[model samples]
Target: MLFFFFYLFFFKLSAQTNLKGKIYFDNEPKSNVTVYLNNTTTGTITNKNGEFNLEVKNGVYQLIISHIGFQTIKYNFDTSTYTKPLVFSLLEEEFVLDEVIINGKENNDEWEYSFSVFFREFIGTSEFSKFCTIQNPDVLFFEFDSENNILTAEAIEPLHIKNEALGYDIFYDLKHFSIEKKFTKYLGYSYFKELKGNKNKQKKWRKNRLKAYNGSQVHFYKSIIKNSSKKEGFVINQFVRKKNNDRPSQEELSKARKELSKSNVALNFSRKIDKPKNSIDSALVILKKAKLPKYIDYLYKSEIASSDIIHKENNQTYLQFDNNLRITYLREKEEKGYILRNPFSKPRKAFLQASNIIPLAEKFIIYPKGILANPLDVLYEEYWSYEKFAHSLPLDYEPNNDD
Candidate 1:
């Protein structure tokens, strides 16, 4: 029998609406405030007068305004309703000691465990994470609520992260990070600055960047826009899971019990316990297989589906689907060859799932210029979810054309 190990693997802007804004703290103009659209590099620091302007296309964006001493603020801005320069008033943050002493000796273990968990989730588990280091881990404060089963983390200062894999120095202003039983979520603003490298290092970085881009969400979106998803090794299949209403009746159970009794009788009469034991094992296997389909109905099977790409006017593309979508990116021939030599190797095939059945609103959207922006836009449930900051690239990063 061939043992098949199924493994799950895992934006841009355009055009001409000016978003002018002023940031204030306690009714005083706050200069040097970093203002930017979340998940994109399009941003600017406030001038001496606390004024800044950004030109963006008509779309929905999460605007982040952050300063050193005050609390960071995020606002959802729609360009359609934006008319004039926006004014933001940020309040000062008050630091107070907790009376309950949550960080006592009893909770030290819990805190350490939570920190480890946070590091793994936030930095990721990929090879990239091996080279990524958090310079100011001491700035993070962790809390756990046993009643809610939530692990929360906050940072007093911007996290200094040095990524040797992608060659970037990142300053991340983490607002919140939480891990519940089923979900892990975090919200933060990051500023990525490229590291200076020699010619050979630059070449290596470009090669690595292209490797990261392939089989990524950005690559998938671009392939969809170009109507070349299949050509790009992407397989879109409809995932169907049906409710199994056919359960074993009482009569069936009684019959099964009677058969077992008969087998026992045969074993005693023949005075051969070993043969009957094998018979009983075979019978159990058959019975288990018979009832398996009913109890294990959640196992999804893929069905053939038509193309999901929909091209609209003005260069807009949509991946329209009703039920859940199972996307698979097949490995290249070279990658498969490498895997053949090493059976324990990680599979190059990448899988991701996007469902409309999520409890929250749909997070994915396709922009007019074929740029897909929004962290919440797609809930990557499989191997892609394992990709965190270590696998992340800047918004302005473009893969090398030669690749």
Candidate 2:
């Protein structure tokens, strides 16, 4: 595994260029600032002069600069066009006092519940999440807005996360985290440093990483770029929601209810409906007959046949599609063994669905290096979106050569 990682690192560096930068705050050079590419392990720290240099591969990357007592900043740049030294000025964060106070007992209870929710959402719920620990949970502060049904969290300092499953200690400078009933979004900067492990432990991690990579979006993207999607056990199909036109009109519903009331036969074999006792009962019966099956059928038939649209321009490849896509990985399953496991593995539905279809705008172009320059180009729905930190791999990660 170490050899594989080394090979990848060297290969990437060979095709990379240098990005030098300095950090400043209030027109003064800031020392000891940590600078990194978001979602990748490539990073460096500012020296006494607040200057650092990084060798980055050809892709669009979010450059994150963070330090203690200052607001972290993320700047998106494409290596193809950004050939100048990057200068970042970070603002100092103002300290604010909490207006609301909670009693000791209440505070403890609320903190416990909120922390559990945040931990689950942040680290994820896979087997990896079980072993991942927040070494400094005390640095975290949580707030819940009951009226808006939103939960927010921030950190006083960088979160030290120990991922036993993947064998890495991640220094995560969490800028913001929020969770609502329908959606979860968080933005932060992270630096992943390898954890020392014995030979057996390293072997286990390698095996698990392979399992996680197999049917993942990263693998899918790479496969698509390589024109080997089918070879990689991925089956793609275009999906479209069925138009709902099965709703019964008021007159039809009224007629059906009257017929049901007059009939001697039962709605089901066990229970006979001689007559509805009230208008409410009559309406219930009518709705049960008119709505349930049609709704179910619509859901079942929502998917339509389609294929991924691939095109190339200026040596860069792009995927284009008009509707929702049903992505099926024949070899991937809801298993606990994969290191980079899917959070939505045990989905109720048979196939994974990616919806909220949108095209890749100029800002979201893909680089020839097989990285999504802008990951936020298309918003995923259902299972695809449920996949969070547990399924994430650094952009520099590559599957084992044997796999």
- The number of the candidate with the highest TM-score is 2
113-187: candidate 2 lDDT, tens digit per residue? 888987766776666677788999877777778899987887877899887777667888776678877556666
Q: Candidate 2 regions off by >4 Å?
A: 1-14, 26-28, 78-86, 95-106, 243-277, 283-307, 313-316, 336-364, 368-371, 401-403
Model 1: per-residue Cα lDDT over 1-403, one tens digit each: 0010111100235556889999887788889988877655567899988899987666667687877667778788777778889999987766542533246214767657776888877886666788899998777777767799877787777888988887878878886687877577777777677779998877777777776666666676677776777887767665545654455555665665567677744433323333334656544433443454553224254532334444364554445554455667674222322234337656666323222212123334465333444444445554456456676775556676525
> Candidate 1: global Cα-lDDT?
0.62
After superposition, the stretches of candidate 1 with alpha carbons farther than 4 Å from their true spots are: 1-12, 16-20, 53-60, 76-86, 94-109, 242-306, 309-318, 331-364, 368-378, 400-403
Deviation in Å, model 2, residue 1 alpha carbon: 34
TM-scores of all candidate predictions against the true structure:
0.67, 0.73
Q: Number of clashes in model 1? A: 2
The alpha-carbon root-mean-square deviation between model 2 and the true structure, to one decimal in Å, is: 7.7
What is the lDDT of every predicted structure here?
0.62, 0.64
